[model samples]
Target: MSGSPPAGSQQQGAVPNPGSPGPSSPTAGNSGSSVLVHVAGAVVHPGVVELPSGSRVYQAIAAAGGELPEAAADAVNLAAVLQDGEQLFIRTKDQAAAVPGPGAQSGAAGAAGPPPGGAVIGPTAGTIVDLNTAGLAELMTLPRVGPVLAQRILDFRRQHGTFATAQELDAVDGIGPKLLASLLPLLRV
Candidate 1:
């Protein structure tokens, strides 16, 4: 027993905590919280991936089976943090060039679709957001809507039931004329 370690204790830092998630675990970070991101475009696999919360864009790309040879990987800010229900689209080199960068001209709201080359990263940018069924994450995708407003909308729906008309959203607390008008085109009852 001279050279043996204590029976109840192991070498310091040598034994991992059994209760903790290992590096290989899907929930290694963010305390077991995870987010689903839809990675589309030039990746080898285009689909949704479940990543630990606070995962970066590059992780999403890797989760989608890595970028294709033709993917304009440089166009993506790989260090950007991923959000739940987010869509991370990788465009081809040619497509990347076609899509304007920040400060570029965007058509009137809801008048035109997202720019070519998958420049838009929102999950509901050009898609219809069903007010009655939309969740907090989906509602947050709308312009000018944040966690508080999104929750308010949900509370309103639960209290008053399904929205009969798109305009009905204005009745929700904090949803003023300007906000309602801005969200009208992107919302559907």
Candidate 2:
């Protein structure tokens, strides 16, 4: 027989090569790529979680120790794809009720109104700013959107045309998932 070990056999105390894919190696499975998401609100353990890329909202919730008993499941789209740096807010039943109903363009009981010339719906349904038509001043009114970021948003819109969806803001620099979540309820096509 040739001077060689049989198939699947290796020398005693032998170690895998550095470049080889071991059983625990990330490349051996789908564990290598991951997306960081921040899950807050009515979760059992709310915090940032690193989930496999392409994970959904439900998965992120599970990663955050699953939702609390008071979690308003109906308020969230659990099947929604999770994006890196995104924040998933799990509202309670009361908080869910605070969200405005459809076509609620204005009039939130005991809620603060939107800025001048802006329409307020409810606590969750903030003013709707059209991405296509909002000027620099209007854009700057968004949470965490300062002059520089608003200018960048304008520049992006100028170069790329109107945003297809609020998530498209992620394409603009300085806008991460947390910021996008805050801006989503306040934006229109």
Candidate 3:
């Protein structure tokens, strides 16, 4: 046991060496990283929350201190896997009536889906990405936009300011009229 720590015990006053990498250190090949999600609307504490990747929507809501008494939690599929930079909007009961919950009928009376930046469907499935708030990864989910185009869009936002409408994407390099048209249906400002 020479110079070795005693079984399940350490020398008194001994401290961990800061320069050394521990087994649980982030640099130790840990792939279970966290994702940042914006939990807004009707939650007790609405804001950006950092949760482990692959965390479910319910977990994000829990992180945000759970839903408010008026929150229509049933409107959102809590089991849905969350994506980084995604926004989870919890609508109130009144709001849910206008924007039909999960399996609610969508005829002349009920709207087909939530309004722009409203309730999110699955991760990047039917969610309308907000041009002013989207990050690189979320922007890449749009049609005809890869890493480079996404970066260009981000750069444009940084340079010019928030886009007033989806049509303003035409100002970004490589986003022609046709591409903008294709993305219009999926994007909002």
Estimate every model's Cα lDDT from 0 to 1: 0.59, 0.55, 0.59
Q: Which structure among the candidates has the greatest TM-score?
A: 1
Candidate 3 accuracy as TM-score: 0.45
State the weakest 10-residue window (summed lDDT) of model 3. Answer: 1-10
Query: In candidate 3, what are the lDDT values of residues 92-143, reduced to their tens digit?
Result: 6666665422232111213433333233332234668889888654564454
Candidate 1 TM-score versus the reference: 0.47
Task: Look at candidate 2 and tell me the lDDT of residue 115.
Answer: 27
Error of 3 at 13 (Å): 35
True-vs-predicted CA distance for residue 58, candidate 3, Å: 0.4
Residue 24 error, candidate 3, Å: 20
Query: Per-candidate TM vs. native?
Result: 0.47, 0.45, 0.45
lDDT by residue (21-140, candidate 1, tens digit) is: 333334434455777677777776677766677777766666565677887777555665676775676767776675433232122223332233223343423568778866554565
**Stronger candidate by TM-score (1 vs 3):** 1
Q: Estimate the TM-score for candidate 2.
A: 0.45
Show where candidate 2 strays beyond 4 Å: 1-29, 104-189
